[model samples]
Target chain A: MLFDFAKSPIVSERQYDVCILGAGAAGIALALRLGRAGKRVALCEGGGLDYEDESQEIYAGHTFGDPYFDLDIARLRYFGGSTNHWGGYCRSFEPVDFNRGYLGDDFRWPITHDDILPYLPEACDIVEISSDYQDRLVDEELGLRQVDFKYSPPVRFGEKFQDEIERSKNIELFLNCNFTDLIGADRRVRSVKFRNYADQELELRASAVVFAMGGIDNSRQLLWMERRHGARFFDRDLPIGRYWMEHPHFTIGEALIKSWDQANLYFALTEKMQKSLGILGCGVVVEEQGDSTTKRLIKDLLCVAPGIGAWAADLAGKKLICSYRFHAAWEQAPNRENRVALSDRAVDRFGVPQSELHWRKARIDRETMLASTQQFNAFMLRENLGRLQLRDWVYQGDEYPDDDVLAGYHHMGGTRMSSTPRYGVVDGNCKVFGAENLYVAGSSLYTTAGYNNPTLAIVQFALRLADHLGKVV
Target chain B: MNRRFFSIAGFLALSLGHVPLFRRYFPQRIKNGWLLKDEDV
Candidate 1:
């Protein structure tokens, strides 16, 4: 069975068992998983691969989280979604993280950490990281002694899995298509509308629709369509585009650790610690920030050894951009106020309502910064090998409601999954709370920022959703 | 002159030591830097 989806928009009356939207990490990951299970799938994505689109801009948009920090955040109008630009940070979300115990909100996730834990290997495949990083926190609920770190040969999935996706008989990847809105009957979402960039093709429909657009676009698209199309259709009874969260992380400090032979910060780890921490995939450095959480670069500390930097300098600016951004992928906590909602939105070139993110910090968010500073200091004290220094003019925040420069790469929790439709948009299994055959695939479903990053968790959840949907949807 | 004053003070202290003279006070906040405000959740 050959599936031919070229530049032509797939808006015909064909019935696919699964219609996945936004071919970024979440969308492509789920599509791949479902296709592997012999399920017929149609995947749609906005934007094109890499930074190829002439219009793609990182710093032009409003700051929901600092857009500048996420240099690789690109939406492919093509296949294999944003993984084309994503850094391969393959760390798992811990168990207690699933609960809303810390947030004090009525929200609780429908799924547990254990439910999606088994899909780590598949998640590794989706991220194109090593399968054997022992210390990379495998099923931490089962007794997390230390993290297992590994490095991806660091290839993005768009290039890595392009052949496989194209070759997959069960998967039909529809590129250059945008998910306009959803079409549902009764209480179930039956299909979603896909329009072409040139408007050559009309609205295409499928049986099941998944909004796999990245966090910002997903929130904007859902809320935009909801406002224009009416509230009764797309899970509108709940906070449709409210209570958004992003991990407010900053580059508080950097250090040169002499523990490894390379004696640099970012990527020189001995085979022993990598082995001790379960080496082979994710990169980790537990260093101190003294008393600041400035920019969101994974876990207060990261490293890029001298040799790699030397090789990178020769690659020139644009040539080595993807690799350089891939090196710097890391984040910390998700503060609720550091989110996006409807503002004085101006429509983008696509005529879709783009958000003016009121990405401000409240007094409560300051506690995390203070805590980050404290924690960094403690970690530096404990791990005595590295000498920590401020990146200079790095500690941006003064206090709570203090205007601190912060941003989050992991656009988490807008159409969050919960047991209750009132508190969330989807169920634990990634299903729309009230509607059948409607789903979401992105970091937006995360109830909290578990500090370990969302790609791993999103992939795991996507795989689980496929399994669950296979049985029921 | 300082010795004479010390001697007098020592005598006064000796006299005062026999009698209930002073009490102590404690500061708010604990040693670990945690402060307690209201008890309500």
Candidate 2:
């Protein structure tokens, strides 16, 4: 049953088996899974059904190191979380992404791709997409190896599953409930402190606490807890807010494709080639230009190459003049320096310290982009597929283009999972080390940010955590 | 020597300028395995 925290009378003490903070994709998925298994869950949402100006202001903080989106605009605080604006491009992480050496460092997923593969169909169903990702139906004659991405009609969890959440006997959703602090004694978390939009203070006691807040908030809360309680609040060597990653994406350049069929081949990567190259996930998209841009391109080409220009000019009124804008989204290796920390100066209206993001692209990230684009350029040229003019930064070695480089809004890795406590905040089971009952259930727990969007994997991991929690609790 | 060379060079240039012929026969002979189409640009 859904309850508004502001409207409800002050309860003496509320108790549950599991209390999940932040009713986003991860939280909602976990709540529903556990609720089905007869565990009482209190799913807390920071905002109500729609967007709120005051709630969003709480996310405002300073960016320290790299150029990044304003903290306020980067995420949403509403019931469905960032899924409210997610582009819904879904693809699973490749097996290579889970490897330790992929990033050439200590970073590695304690869990393998196989561990989450079984739950992907369920995750796809939850996000309302086709479960079958195989591309056998795409004609091979197109010369493109079909890479599958199931677009979610973009499910807003609050609206899509309102009935299920409302009807569930075991789940109680608290709207306008912002998680303030974790109340813990020894090694296990006992309860959580929260406040409503109206600043009504409340506390909830639960056997297990799952922080399903989005990447930024997940780390922010943990950092805040560690600061308030002590250094070893969660664990003795808790790497609570480190190893942050983002899928850095930009338009690398333009490719002149005489035919759409020829250009499509360069757009997607085959599994065989991806494995052979040991690439940590990259996708190419060929976006067609509009009429005005097409005319300009043809006019520009006519000055030098009259043969192709004449051909292009003939089709000005007949068809779309095929100038494909080449876009690439590549994985950012987890960098410890690129992290989330509590701002020493800033605090929200509730007097809670705001989060400070320190983000920068590593040298390896630039090298990988260069290598991948060069490899693609070579392949296209060899096959006589098309002529590709690479962006300036790609040809200019060693330095990443700082001017217009944008992240894919995919925040990952902070409470990264590891078997050994020295490297990560959480264990393979998503439980914070030393804190037996506390678990994290979002992209923040990701050890690596694969090029694919995080929503599908977030749901998959949440479901995995639910199954684990169901068996134990 | 100059006249003879010029005549031969002009003939070769004209023959190579035949894009249709190059599209039809050159790909099979070159064997570089590029998908050469016999269509307009």
Full-model lDDT, candidate 2: 0.76
* Candidate 2 residue-wise lDDT, A1-473, digit = tens: 88888687456376799999988899999999999999999999988888999888888988877677898988899888888888888887767678645445556678898999899989999999988877542323322344667889888887898799999999998888888887778767788888987778888899999988889888888887877787434676577789888988877776555556444432444444545545556666667766676666667655545555576676655663467777788888788788888888989887778888898887666645545555555555455545454555554332456666488889898899987777788999999988878899999998888778889999999999999998777
After TM-score superposition, what is the CA distance of residue A149 in candidate 2 from its true location, in Å? 1.1
lDDT of 1 by residue, A314-380 (tens): 3323232111110112233334344455546456655665665645544434343333333333343
TM-score for the A chain of candidate 2: 0.91
Best by TM-score: 2
> Per-residue lDDT of B5-26 in model 1, one digit per residue for the tens?
9999999988877521111101
What DockQ results do all the predictions give, each relative to the true complex? 0.02, 0.03
Docking class of 1: incorrect
Candidate 1: deviation at residue A405, Å? 9.0
Model 2, B1-41: lDDT tens digits are 99999999999998877554222212221112222233312
Q: Estimate each model's TM-score.
A: 0.68, 0.84
True-contact fraction per candidate equals 0.00, 0.02
